[model samples]
Target: MTRLTETARGVYVIAATPFTDSGEIDFDSCDRMVDFYLDAGATGLTVLGIMGEAPKLTTDESSTIVARILKRVNGRVPVVVGASAPGFAQMQDLTRRVMDAGAAGVMVAPPGSLRTDDQIVTYYTQVAEFLGDTPFVVQDFPLTTGVQMAVPALARIFNSLPTAVCLKHEDWPGLAKITALRKDGTLNRRISILCGNGGVFLPEEMERGADGAMTGFAYPEMMVSVVEHHAKGDMERARDLFDAYLPLARMEQQPGAGLAIRKYIMFRRGIIASPAQRKPGANLDALSRAEIDTLMARLDRRLKELA
Candidate 1:
């Protein structure tokens, strides 16, 4: 197994699930999307994430998609499958299937009902027990999960769970959390901290001790470039690149409508054959599409200037 580890850094593009106009999984587009990510310099790929429409997929479909992705990825880079579930049985089953399918690891988000610090810690304790030796990433996206993990709770988790190797840190205003986690003696051991607010606060987060990004922005090359420049100690270049894509990134980060916008851009870029969303998913109207086009145009010009 290509286990994910604390040293994992750089862009791990949260992949989108491609579907045909007829609403079937578009396997061909899945392959193309993987290729596009690799060409964009993605160090890793995360599948079945929230942006990937994991909840929308059936159990059989989820397993099939993971198998197809692992086959297509062919061990080129680590693939982390989102295995969060309402029950331990489902989570464990999914994790076992994906790991058996050759995934590098899994990402588990806290259940939305968890609130108190003890509840959060207990929930992860159960998760750690279920996952056993499988390395997992703790997804700390409070905006969507409704389960805010305080600094002390998070520290307790990291200190206790040996298998918790990385954090998909998406808590808004999470810069201080990163600083807290990186401070001396805060955690029993170090784990990678990657921000995921569509790379909106990536510059500050990086400066605040984040390892990198694990978000699903349409243009992952932008995230890759930002992290690369930051790693090279060129803050100006990093911010310039980030600023060039900020408009589109903001537009793509919309809550309910964001996935449709992202799929449309991916379709326009020829990474996917269609921007079709499954039932219970939103589709972009003419006005939204026009706005995205305008943003893309501005991004193009700005990127050229930066270049």
Candidate 2:
């Protein structure tokens, strides 16, 4: 297994869980999605994240999907599973299962109840202890978790936890925080910093010292291109590509409707079989779907013009 480490970089496309119209797991679509991501230049894959509808799956279903994707990936790239849960036992169990099944690592998020620096650091300390020797990613998504962790607090987690190897940085208005973390001596040792939020701010995050994106935007190729161009010192091309996708990227960042829009686009692009979310989730109305159609058409024209 290619375990995720501090050196990990590039787009780790957060894989979405595909479901049939009747709400059954669409394993065939899952396989095709995996192929699409790899061909799109994703360096790694993260499954069972918030966008993956993880909380909706049974324990058996989650394991099966991870195993299936890992099998499909066949060690082509590192695969990180989102193992965040309400309790350590659940988290530990999932971590062990996926790691043993050849997952590169797992990601854990701070629960919303955590409200202090010590609480945040202490929580991750216990996580590192429970999943002894298993590499993990610290998902600092304050927008979703509601736990505001300053750079110092996150540095404390990384400095203290040898197993914490990467940060899924999703703090809104968080570019300065990235600059802070990249400063000398701010962290005891370096760890990978991959931004989230659908890659809307990816170009800026790269400028602020992020390695790459760990997001679930429908266009993984755009993130891949931006990172590749930036790494090659071609900022003009990077920004041009980023600008072309900005409208759709902004549209996909909507609060409740983002996932629906993403799935619908993937379905339209023939990457998935169904665009339906599971029950108790959001779906796009006809007007919203039409709007997305218009945006995608414009994006295609923009890309060709750039070419």
Best by lDDT: 2
Candidate 1 — which residues are off by over 4 angstroms? none
Output the lDDT of residue 207, model 2.
Answer: 90
Candidate 1 per-residue C-alpha lDDT over 1-307 given as tens digits, one digit per residue, 9 for 90 to 100: 6899999999999999999998899999999999999999998999999999899899999999999988988998999999999999999999999999999899999999997999999999999999989999999999999999989999999899989999999998788889999999999888999889888999999999988899899999999998999999999999988888888899888889999999999998899999999888998999989989988888888878777
TM-score of 1: 0.98
Report the C-alpha lDDT of model 2 over 1-307, residue by residue, as the tens digit: 7888999999999999999999999999999999999999999999999999999999889999999999999999999999999999999999999999999999999899999999999999999999999999999998998999998899899998899999999999999999999999999887999999999999999998999999999999999999999999998999999999999999999998999999999999999999988887898889999999999999999999999
Name the best candidate (by TM-score): 2
TM-score of each: 0.98, 0.99
Query: Please, what's the RMSD in Å of model 1?
Result: 0.9
What global local distance difference test value does model 1 have? 0.92
